[model samples]
Target: MDLKNLHVLQQLMDLSQDCFLVPGPVRMGQPCLNALSTPVMTARGPEFRDVMAHLNSGLRNAFNLAPSEPVRGVQSWSGDDDYKVVVVSGSGTAAMEMVIANRFRSNDLVLVPTNGKFGERVAEMCQRFCNVKHLKYEWGRAFDLYELERQLERGCYESLLICHNETSTGITQDAAAIAEMCARHNTSFILDGITSVGGMPVHPTEWKAEAVVVGAQKCTAGPSGIAAIAINSNFIERVHAIRDQGDSNPNYYLDLVAALKKGGDDQTPWTPAINLAMGWGAALDVLKNESNKVRWDRCETMANGVRNLFLDLGFELLADAEQRSSTVTSILYPEGIDDAWRARLKEEFNTQVIGAQDHLKGKMFRIGSMGETPISEMVEGCKRMIECFTQFGMELPKVDVESYFK
Candidate 1:
C-alpha cells in the first residue's frame, strides 16, 4: 500500500463520510415554502452604517436600560441589580455550562428535575461539572409541587435546576412554584427558559429564579448563535468570590464575570457572530413592540387548534390538556401503524412533523406552532395530517379545521 494515498485516502473517500452534510427533513423556520422563510435581510450601505452607529443604543432601548449596563439587555430580568448578563457563542447549553462552572464548588450538590430531553440535558450538564442529585419525573408528566418541596427539604443541594418548558415532550413546568419551593429550602433556583421566554409567560424576577437562561432560536425568533443567562446579585457575588480566591473555572469562553467586565461593545471572548447579533436585535424589537398577552394567546389558540384536530383524528396527547405547552404538542401515533406511514405523510403531503425522542420515538410525534406560523397554515397542516392518517388505513373523523382559525 502506498501509505500516502492508500489508507488515509481510502478512509477519506468512504461513502459514510458524506452522510454528515446530507440535508435532513425540513424544520420549522426553514419550511419548504420560500415565501414563509425567515427573512434575514442584512443592512446595506447607509442602513448598515446607521445600524452600526446605533446598535448598542437600540439594544439598551429595547430593555429600557442604560448603554453602560453591566448586563446584556437581551436577557430576562432575574431579580437582581448587581448580577451581569453575558452573551455566549453556543445556545442554552453555553448558558447552562457558564452558570454551572461559575456557581458550583467541587462537592456542592445540585438538584435536577428531569421531565424531558432538555431537563435530562440539565442533569447531564450538572453531572459533568458538579455533584448532581436528580429529581426525576416521567416524560410528558408534570411533577407535583408538594412532592418536589418535600424532596428538596430532605435533599442536600445548593441549587435546583429545571427546564421551564420541556419542548421535547410539550410540557411546561411551573417555574414560579418550583422557585418558591427552592426558596423555602434556601436553595438557589436555575431555570432553562430556552423555549419559553418570549412566546410563553416567564417572569424570572417574579418566579424567584436566581439564575435564568434563554437561547435566541426558540421563542425569540432570532438566529441560534446567541444565548443569555441572567444571574442574581447574590449568585454573582458568590461567583466573584470564587474567582477572586483563584479557583479555576473550567470553561474560559463562558466566564460571565470576565465577559461583563469587557462590555458588549468589545468582541466576545471568542469572535462574536455579528450577523446573529443583528438578527437578534431586530427580533427583540419585534417582541418588545408586540403585546405579550396577544403573542401568548396566539400560541395558545394555535396549540388548541392542533389538539382539537388530534382529538378529531382519534389520537391521544402525551400531556394532559391543561398542562400541555402552548408552543408545541406531542400526540400519540395511531395504534399498529408502521414508520413507513410517517414517511409517506412527509413525502406525499410536503408537511413536516417531529417524531418523539428516545423511548417515545415511534410511539408519538410532536407538532409545533411557533415562530411566525400563520393560524391558517397550522389548520392546513393539521388537515393534511388527518388526511395522511386516513391514507394509512386509519379512518379519522372530519374536523372543522376552518372554525379553529376563529
Candidate 2:
C-alpha cells in the first residue's frame, strides 16, 4: 500500500495490518467498526433516545458508578440514582475542561499534581478556570502522598485534580489512597481516567470523586472524538449553585449544566457525533459483557508479557515497576537502538507502536495492551522487535515469547 498517495482517512483504515499496539486510540474490534457504519438519526427522536439510554447504562457500568457489587471491593451506594453520566461530542480534554469549568469558581483554590504529560495538561486546564497550585515531578515517577497531605493541610483547596492513569509515561497513580486523603480533607476529587476506566478497575462512587472523565478511544476500543464524565450528586448540586449565581461558567458549547438538563430526556444540548456515540456504545457493551475482572486480568497478562519480553531482550522500562500501568507499557531504548527501529518494525513487520512525546522522543517507545488484541499478534510483534534489534548489530538471546503468556 502506497500510504502517501492515499487520503488521510483512507490511510488510517489501511494502516495496522498485523499488529496494532499504539497507546491510544488503540485498535478497535469488528463490532465497534460495524456500529460506526450505522445511519445517523435525530438527536431528539425516540430512536436516538434509545441509543443514548443504552450508552449511558453501559458507561455507568464501565465507570463502576452504578449500584453493582460484581466489581472488586465496591458496595452499593444510596445516591447511585442521583449520579449522571454525560456524553460530549469532543475528546477527553473537552470532558475534563467541561467539568473544571462547572465545578470551580475563579476564587476557588485547586491543587494539581503532575508526573506526566496528561497530568501537566490537567494543571494547565485548571489554571485557566481557577487559582491553581501546581506540583511537578519527574516523568514516570509516582507522586508523594505525604507531600500532597501537607499541601492539603496548609492550603484551603476547594478541589484536587489528578490523572489516574498517565498514558504518556505508562504510570498508574494510587487513586484509592488519594481519594481517601481527599475525603479526609473534605475536598472534591476530580480524576482523569482516560486510559484506566475500562481496561482496569475504577470506582468513582467508592472513590467519592466529584467527576471522572474517560475517552472513548482509550480503553473502550471505540472511535475518537467522544468522551464521557461520571458525576456524583454533590457535583450536580455544586453545578446548580454555580448556575444560580448566573453565568459563572464561561463556556457555552461545553456547558455541563445544559448537558444535565438535556440528559433527563436522553439528549445532548447540541448535535453530537452520532456515529462515534454508536461505536462507543457497542464498545462499552463488550466491556460490560466480559466483566471487569476478566478484562483487568487480560490486560495484566498482556502488560506483564510485554514488559518481560522487553526486559529479556536487554531493554529498560520508563515507569517505576510498582506504578507501571497495565494498559500501556513504556520501554526505554537500548544502547544501539534509535527511532529508525520503529520504522523498520512498521514497514518490514507491519507492527504499529507509539513514540515518546516531548523531550523523551527517540529515548522511549510505548506499546498498548488495551482493547481486544490477540495474544498471538503480541507474540509475533515481540519477535519482530527482536529481529530489528539484531539488525542494529546488537546480538540478542533466544527468548520464549510464548512462555510469558503461560
Best by lDDT: 2
lDDT of 1 by residue, 21-82 (tens): 00011122322133224354343333333333233333333322324322333332221243
Q: What's the TM-score of every candidate structure?
A: 0.80, 0.92
lDDT of 2 by residue, 1-406 (tens): 2445334523433335578888789887888999989987887787777777777777887787654332211322122565678898899999999999989888888999999999999999998988899999999999999999999987599999999999999999999999999999999999999999888888887889988899999888888999999888899999889789874758899988888878767788899788888898899888888887788888888899999888887889999889889999999988757789899778766788889999999999999998777677777677767766776688888888889976
Backbone clash count, each prediction separately: 0, 0
Stretches > 4 Å off in candidate 2? 1-17, 67-82
Span of 10 residues, lowest total lDDT, candidate 1? 17-26
**lDDT at position 157, candidate 2:** 95
| Cα distance off (Å), candidate 1, residue 188 | 1.1
Candidate 2's TM-score reads 0.92
